[model samples]
Target: MESKSKNAPAKLHLRSGDTVKVISGNAKGETGVVKKILVDKLRATVEGVNMITKHVKPNAQNPQGSIEKLEGSIHISNLQVVDPKTGEPTRTGRKLNDKGKLQRFAKKSGNFI
Candidate 1:
C-alpha cells in the first residue's frame, strides 16, 4: 500500500532585503539587512551581525590563508524586523488594505515595514 505524505513548504519569515535586528544574542542591538534565509535550517543571515572570524586554508582560490570576517546563520527567533519609520524592532504582519493589496506592517511603528 502506498501512503500519501502531508508536508508544507518552508516559509522563510525574513526575506532578503528586509531590515532586521538581533533580538537576543551576542550581537543583540545590532541591526542589518537580511541577506539570505536558510529555509531548511530556519535561520537567516543578517549583514553586519553575528560576525565571526573564519580561517582559510591554502587553496587555489586563495594563495594566502588568512582570517576573514563573515556573517553566520542566526536562528529566526533571534531576529526581529525593524521599522523604517520609527527605527525600532517590530513584529511583521500582513493586512489587505482598501485597494486589496497585501502589505506588511510593523506592530510597533504602525507603519509599513
Candidate 2:
C-alpha cells in the first residue's frame, strides 16, 4: 500500500499577493491577501485571517518577552481566489495567452488575474 506521506505536494492555483476569501472555518467569508504558501503541507497563510497568539522570547529585536498575535495557516482547499474584475471569489485556471505564454485567469470573470 502507498503511504500518504510519500504522495507529492499539492499544486495550488493561488499565488502570493493574490486576494482570497476563506471558504470555511472560523474566518469563513473573510477576504485577505495570500501571504505565504506551504506547498508541502497544502496550507497558505492569509493576512488578517486565522489570528493566533504565541508566546515570544526576548532577543536582540526586543528586550522583553511578549505575546505576539499573528496570522495562522489555512488549508489551501479552504481558500478561493477573488476575481479582481468582479470582486468575487472565483476559481482559477491557466491557459496560453496570445504570445503562447502561460497565464493564470479567473474562471468567473474570464479575465487575467
Candidate 3:
C-alpha cells in the first residue's frame, strides 16, 4: 500500500555541520558534529562516533593493506541536537523569527540555534 506521497523523502531532524549527541547505542553519551544526513534512510553520520573499521587493499599510495577507521551512520532516533547557548543536548522547535522566516530554535534555552 502506497501513501499519499510515495516519492517524497522522509523528514530528518539532523543537518550537516550541526553538533549532535548520541543518546543511545554503543556510542551513547558521545558528542560529535553531524557529517551527513541520510534522509531516505533516516540516519546520520556523526564525526568521531560509531567508529567502524574497513580493510583497505594495497594501493599505489600504500604497499601494505591498511585498516581504516570511519564514522558509521546512526539512526536519527538515537541522536539529539546540542543547544548552542547551553552547550547541552536539547530538543528543537520551529518558530517564526523577527524577519518572519521560519527558523529552528533550542527549546530548552528559548534561543535560536
What TM-score, over all chains together, does every model reach? 0.84, 0.87, 0.90
Task: Please write out the lDDT profile of model 3 over residues 1-113, one tens digit for every residue.
Answer: 87533689865567899999999999999999998988767889999999999999998889898999998999999999999999999998889999999889999999998
Rank list by TM-score = 3, 2, 1
C-alpha RMSD of each candidate structure in angstroms: 3.8, 2.2, 1.8
Top candidate, metric lDDT? 2
Task: Give the top-scoring candidate (TM-score).
Answer: 3
The reply for model 1, stretches above 4 Å from the true place, is 1-6
Model 1 lDDT tens row, 13-67 = 5788999989898999899999998776678899888989999998998899899
- Candidate 3 residue runs with Cα over 4 Å from true position: 3-6
Which residue pairs show backbone clashes in model 1? Answer: none
